[model samples]
Target: LVPPDILKKMYVLRRILNPMGTVDAIEFLLGKLRETKVNAEFFEKMNT
Candidate 1:
């Protein structure tokens, strides 16, 4: 598993790679995570 520091860096990288996390291929995954109570609204507003 990635260490916390590394994981944070990876998450940052992911934001840079897809700032909105709205990639067509991952919308369902995002919705599922949201259903599980994960707070992903930050991603929705990242474009701003």
Candidate 2:
């Protein structure tokens, strides 16, 4: 029931949500929002 333009935006959002996706302005913004507070333990837990 969604419009094509909205669906396209959703697809773009999905791509940006990919944790290891290619770097770009959106990814840079996401990284900035991280506050440099994520720890190695968090990554270790995710890797499991």
Candidate 3:
């Protein structure tokens, strides 16, 4: 497996290669993850 540092550099290079698309993709994933976390927390609170 690739080392974490090399993997990070590869991601940076990919972002540099396609800046707008990369940013948009990252934002979309972050938003989806945030929504999932909020929903999970809401359910957990309800279960308590």
The predictions' CA RMSDs to the true structure, in order, are 10.0, 12.3, 11.4
**Against the true structure, what is each candidate's TM-score?**
0.37, 0.39, 0.37
Candidate 2: regions farther than 4 A off: 20-48
What is the per-residue lDDT of model 1 for residues 1-48, given as tens digits with 9 covering 90 to 100? Answer: 765655565576466557555575377446544655434443333333
Give each model's whole-structure lDDT.
0.52, 0.53, 0.54
* Candidate 3, number of clashes: 0
How many clashing residue pairs appear in each of the predictions shown?
A: 0, 0, 0
Query: For residues 1-48, what per-residue lDDT tens digits would candidate 2 score against the true structure?
Result: 975655665566556567654666577646654744564332323312
Worst lDDT run of 10 residues, candidate 2, spans 39-48
lDDT for 30 in candidate 2 is 62
As for candidate 1, its clashing pairs are: none
The best candidate by TM-score is: 2
How well does candidate 2 score on lDDT at residue 15?
Answer: 63
Alpha-carbon deviation at 3 in model 3, angstroms: 0.3
Best by lDDT: 3
What is the Cα-based TM-score of model 3? 0.37
| Model 2, residue 8: C-alpha shift (Å) | 0.2
